[model samples]
Target chain A: MKEYTMVVLVKQVPDTQNLTGEAMKEDGTVNRSALPAIFNPEDLNALEMALQVREEYGGTVHVITMGPPSAVEVLKEAMYRGADRVYLLSDRKFAGSDTLATSFALKQAIQTKIPDFDIVFCGRQAIDGDTAQVGPQTAEKLDVPQLTYVESIQELGEKKIKVRKLIDNGTEIVETALPVLLTVTDTANEPRPFIAKKLLKYRKAACEFDLPKILPRYPQFKTKEELKNFLKKKGLFIEMWGLEDIKANKDDVGFAGSPTMVKKIESITLTGKGFKKIEPTDEGIAHFVAELIEDHTW
Target chain B: MASNGEVWVYAEHDWNKLQDIGIELLSKGRELADELGVKLASVIIGDKVTRHATILFEHGADKVYACEGSKLDNYDTAKYAKVLTDLTGQYKPQVVLFGASARGRDLAPRVASKLRVGLTADCTDLQIGDFKAPDGTEYKKILYQIRPAFGGNIIATIVNPNTRPQMATVREGVMPPPPSKKGKKGEIVKAIIKMQNLPNLTSILHREKTEKKVNLKASRIIVSGGYGVGSKENFAIIRNLASVLGAEVGASRAAVDAGFIEKDHQVGQTGTTVRPALYIACGISGSVQHRAGMDQSAKIVAINNDPEAPIFSIAHYGIIGDLNEVIPMLIEDIKKRRVE
Candidate 1:
């Protein structure tokens, strides 16, 4: 039996899937008030796939996320399911990063926070951007192989990873070497429910998945010892990593590492109006129905 | 110029069979190739997919790029990316088009980002040459890549002038395939792709294909129901309509919420986005969410008593009456039309 260590990448997004006009920020980013924070739908699936791997193959599932301090909520949600550990990659410097810069920031945090993981999984793309670039770009940054549109992770062995990828018209079976990144599509797998006890206990726990960053705001946490005490009282599990923590070169560690840049942000509207419904004349409607019958494609 | 370089298309395969989109892409690629005066090519990477390669040539690929091996047998994201990215860099095709299928949606953007180019997803239309510069302040010459935006309410033409190769994903069946010779001979460009070392994190143990699957987007005809149907029981009207038309049953978000149908049957922004030729929207209010999915239908017929229903805004025909009366009447009329 080959042991495995899986890392799932998550994002703290304004529950835009459920967001309304109310969540609209003046600048187009979701208004935090209007949009409730939630874990991305695909990221949850990635974590679930990881947990299942651990359940079947026996290993650890570590979840990591990059966002504002509030992102800890998403990491905790991962823990409630069965992730052995979670890491929060929160830094003010990480703000305003597009897909290119965003992937670099996350690669740094993943490298520093989790030393060794056999595989890395992420949602095919973040729903907010729907760009679907981060996972593949991250794979490029990590210099590992990547598989997108992954519907199923078919096999996990020491040397290889096989997945049933959902193609447009059919399915493709894929096998690749490990230590690879995977961007799971919506068809990947449905997430299991949160563990009752874990959810109940940690329901109110402060989302302090990153200790170093949070300590700066709470001056009362003057020392590591004091912060640990406060964390204990708060029952906060703050995963920690610093610039010196990983084998990261300063040049390629942050904004400098990314290649693509967003030149401008525009709130552009796209419309489509076609499908000329023939008038509901008995003759026209009947002919249309006949056409439908001939096509056999309802 | 489209003619300066060959038109590159991402030919899709499902291990055993080639996707219809691959052929559809080839058909469009041939058109684009003609528009630009170049060749059409398909990229196939898998194990023993020669059968598919022959099919690609018939669909109109002037050339085929096939990488066959045990490692290439099944798709490994990392491996496929490296392989495809390396191919793109070497071939340097002007435009690479995908099907906007689940796999295409995921793979296209990754390749685009890797190549530092621009990509448009879920497009319903494709045209060669320049597009308007959407820049508010300055009018720059940009590659007008247009796609349905705001849930199919408008067509947003985007561009990535700064990048090298432009990429776009078209929905299935938008461009029908041209008649191709099943065994047409074409030159196969075999390449040696180096596999990158990767980590093992998670794996799949089983695959049970019995999930509530809905292939609405792929259907040719869709009988979509909406809130005007009143109750879940009214869906029988839709089911009947579908049976007469031999069409797949679809629902608006409202109908899905009313328990008229499963989420899989729901069509909209949050549901399955389809571009069927004939769309019959019964009692469905054309919310942006609902329209996003079915609005791309080649033809739309709306049935409702509410004359001002938003659906009528786009429907080709609107019947001002109850669907219960209209649907059954229409079903009988169709039965009569069949005889005629």
Candidate 2:
């Protein structure tokens, strides 16, 4: 039996689409609470693909995300959909990292969370960064095979797999050896929604056992022991791990491991240039055709 | 401080015929190689690709390293990168170039990272060093890699300060194809391609291919509708024009937001990048995001009621009337022209 492990990279970004009048940030970075947080549409599609792969063949899907602790909201979504394990790399030290530094943190997490990597997948690009660099860069750091703009994955074999790259006209079918990385386009497939049973069971579950939301809802509890007892009774336990639990060096947890620095940020709007409509006369048509000819165009 | 002499071009295959961009890079590489006084080589890998190695001679490749074996059957980025990276270490080219297709987009970053070098993607132009009078032309021999930056607002000239081989990915149709001549020949170097058995990474048991693969990016003609198209029902008139012109139907971001069409047909920064031969805007106001997708089209025609719409900025032809009326008339005129 061949063992297959699929890892998907996800990110948390402000809901850029829901820019309303009530809350607006001049700097372009959103106010965290005012802006809705959702799993990236493309990353969700990537996870849907991974879960489907798991259903067809018996394997594990591991999701690794690097962000603030609030990002765990999406991890629970992944777990609800048959993920074998999930890991988060969250610390204030990783703040203000650009694409280059961001990729470094992800590479470190991929190594720490899963010792071995067979196939890694991610959305073509994130809505916020829009760089589309991290996936390919992560594959480079891992020194594995990569396929981008992937429209379909045809088959998976013992030592090799076949994939379809959406090219200019027709699809290009490729048969490559295993341990390949894929950065998928949204054209791949429609993502699946949450299951009714999984949603109900895992609603209040936490990995950190946060005492804020749960204890207050049930005010009858008098002591810390009773609250823990009720939480255990209600299945609100989370598998929380401290920094030491993951065996990461204290220095490497944040800004120290990052190597990229932001240069600047600018907001721009490009529109309304020149609009000159010429006559339907021969000279006017002749002038336009001549320019096209000079430019070697159709 | 390293060997800044060898110029490498990544090759492509179309219908068993070599991709024109591969030779285009070589032709451009010749100019750079001449200025730097270095050698120009190509990397070609495929099943039975060794037989086509002679194609490099027609161009200006001085050396061709062919990696042809059973393991080289398909393009696996891991295997391809390993082989290409090994060659880079051995040859130490001054620059490595590839077509900016999907493969190139993914491959260039990996190669650059492995070599710990810089890579400029979707480059539009290439020029060898500065002018010759020390500053006049010799500086250009440094291979000024030019690419569109700031979302195509400006073109930036990038160069690797201290890397063995500077790398770049160039878009298709950006440069002219290489011309064929009778007499140039190059040496073909053969290398062994080995593979390693790895674990089963991902099991994609079944992938149902999309029944309809309508890629608008490569289409020659695109007919795009906008908010001026009125209700979603009016989109039929726009579609009629497209059907007659044998073109793909597109939508401005506003049109997609209005539910006039699916997001896939939307042409803009958030949708798809398109550079067709001809673009027809049906009552569009031309938002910046919409213009970003079709600004590169060769010709544009706008039909709007406002007359003050921004889409007129790029339109080569204009009709200040309703699209419902204008589209039918244009379709009639095109039919007449074809019949005549």
Candidate 3:
């Protein structure tokens, strides 16, 4: 098998299950701190496909994420799930990025940090942004082919890969040239759980923000640089890059670069005229259908 | 007249027949164009699909740009994007709209990126408006792309003021189909696209319909269940209700994720968007994700034990009781009504 390099773009999103009324702030922005964050669900599916590719064909799986310092949580989680190397694209300037700016920053990171890649994987969309544009936009930025709503990999070849994509009512099998970007849907594959040994090894993995708090426990490593060197020697240093590290143009990143602006956010309330509640009895059931038929509901 | 400053809608077709969403978009484009003081045009691309341009006129398009070639039969993202991007550069439309179908979703972003413009996906609503950005800069004649986000708990109105030809993909079946004006005629401009210059990066190998066939998008009535349906076997009540009502069966993402039903039967943000004449929900809590798919239905009927379930909020008729009891009673009553 030919060795290939795969990069999976992941996002850490607020857990939708833990949503509360306080999830939205006064400014209509999501209150990220209120909700416990977890790895975006479909992104894990993308990660699994990348890992599967590595397992079938000899290669390395690297995970990349662009978010706040807390996003290292997904990077470490990626390491625990069999990624060989993880890079964190974190910078204060990269905040409030819409999908366009987010994709630009991610494309720069891929070009500068991991220049060569056989395949790029992304979840269909992030639960927070809910925009499935990043993967295709990145593919467009790199001038590569993109396969969205990918279901399964049919055949992997030296120059091309045949895969299945979901359409409106059917699935189409397509063969695309190498160096393609694929946005995997939830049906792509069931993400594998963290390996026990890998979990034990990567559980202690910490980025720069996490180092100071954890360094005090390891007295043997006196300085932050000493602890960093020790972690780097053990192949556990999480590669952290900022906007400057990736050579991203400042005007083209973060709030300044995003073209779409949120004019307003209104909480959804289903204000259908008050419904008529019916008793679960034979007479009531008959009246309900009669009302529906009279009202042209059917 | 040229397509410049015109409101353009990409009319997606599959070789022979035009997609329904294309007509729906033309209906919407007519309004948007009228409001923006621009002509409404439709761009039709496919192998031998120029014949369908007449339909565009009936749907309110003032002009139709038709491109035909064997290479345009099957959708190859890059090739389609290149031709569309070239047209966008030349025509310089103020706004571009597409159906939020699979093909549109794939093609819109690619074109948007190639043209370095903003494209909003799966917008539930589109309107012309003046918008003030967070930086306090005001923009005029912006396309307000409204969509449900964050599990559909809230609606976000997005605007792309900086990019020319502000683009958006609206969901199918949400908008009403236009009333066909049989005598309406439009000018047809044949676009000469060079197929040789396009890159063939991807080729379609095979196309197969999934064994589980459910056309929720076209269904007039839908019966959906959620996690409250309990077990995979317990979903029979839902199926039984659907059969009685002659409606399609639908499932909430929770039920689909729980293995109670196939993904094809799922209806939500990640699944299929549906607009039926009547939607009957049994034991569903109606998360915004599920509601996003079915809220456009003309009427909704919710049956669940929990009165506080969000499903009741939108339901035209609500029944607070066990679905096991309610479904059977409803089915029996419907059977009696047939005889009566």
The candidate that wins on DockQ is 3
lDDT per residue (tens digit) for residues B149-265 in model 2: 333333456555444577778766556456766677888888665556632222323333354455686688898899888878889988898898778999987888889888778
Q: lDDT order of candidates, best first?
A: 3, 1, 2
Candidate 1 chain A lDDT trough over 10 residues, lowest sum: A263-272
Candidate 3 residue-wise lDDT at B231: 94
RMSD of 2: 6.8
Q: Pick the candidate with the highest lDDT.
A: 3
For each candidate in the order shown, give its overall lDDT on alpha carbons: 0.70, 0.68, 0.86
Clashing pairs in 3: none
Over A226-250, each residue of candidate 2 has an lDDT whose tens digit, in order, gives 7776656665444433345445554
TM-score of each: 0.74, 0.71, 0.94
**Which segments of candidate 3 are over 4 A away from where they belong?**
A17-33, A270-273, B1-4, B195-200
Which CAPRI level is candidate 2?
incorrect
Question: Tens-digit lDDT track for model 1 on B56-173?
Answer: 8877898998877876765545456667889988988877888877767666766766775657676666666543333543323323455554323334555555455767777765
